[model samples]
Target: MESISPLQFLKDKSILVIGATGFLGKVFAGKILRIQPNVKKLYLVVRAADAKSAMKQILDEVYVSTS
Candidate 1:
């Protein structure tokens, strides 16, 4: 057995995160990036007025102050 690197696993990978605008999802998504910034893509699913607003919500609420 061997230990696998989180970064290695995430590289060039696309992630679909539901409720990413919420607390837990935010933490998870943030940690993923913090641990592996080279992830190919991060797809976040949230409820908002539109695509623009959904992105805004995710940006404004999630992945902030995660250090």
Candidate 2:
């Protein structure tokens, strides 16, 4: 018998994460990225002035610092 990894369920799938800048959200996002770097897509919902600003904030505050 072989064991199946739950992470395999996320393969090639797109994930949408709300509140991705918050503590739990950031942890969740980091875990997902770390485990499944080849996911189809990741959409992070964040609050900001515009789309560009939201992306920048997430990158600078969450992704960059964590990485």
Candidate 3:
């Protein structure tokens, strides 16, 4: 059997990620972003009080992992 990388599992797909702002989810998302920069897009599900806040949380998670 061939081993598939996590990045391969996400190629050319519109991935809908729930809990992307959470700890585990953020790490998973960060790995994808770092390895698969050409992914279609990153859809994040957040439950903050407002859309701005939710988006901020997602962005913070992803960008923080970059450093």
Tens digit per residue, CA lDDT, model 2, 1-67:
8886868888899999899898888988899899988899988889899989998889887887458
RMSD of each: 2.2, 2.4, 2.5
Clashes per prediction?
0, 0, 0
Task: List where candidate 1 sits over 4 angstroms from the true fold.
Answer: 1-3
The CA root-mean-square deviation of candidate 2, after full C-alpha superposition on the true structure, stands at: 2.4
**Cα-based TM-score, every candidate:** 0.76, 0.81, 0.72
Who wins the lDDT comparison? 2
Candidate 2 TM-score to native: 0.81
Tens-digit lDDT string for candidate 3 (1-67)? 9999877877877877788777877787777777888789778788899988877886677567754
Q: What are the Cα lDDT values of the candidates?
A: 0.82, 0.87, 0.77
For residues 1-67, what per-residue lDDT tens digits would candidate 1 score against the true structure?
Answer: 8988877878999999998877788888889888888888998889888888877776678845454
Model 1, poorest ten-residue lDDT window? 58-67
Candidate 3 TM-score over all chains jointly: 0.72
- Pick the winner on TM-score between candidates 1 and 3: 1
Score residue 27 of candidate 3 by CA lDDT: 83
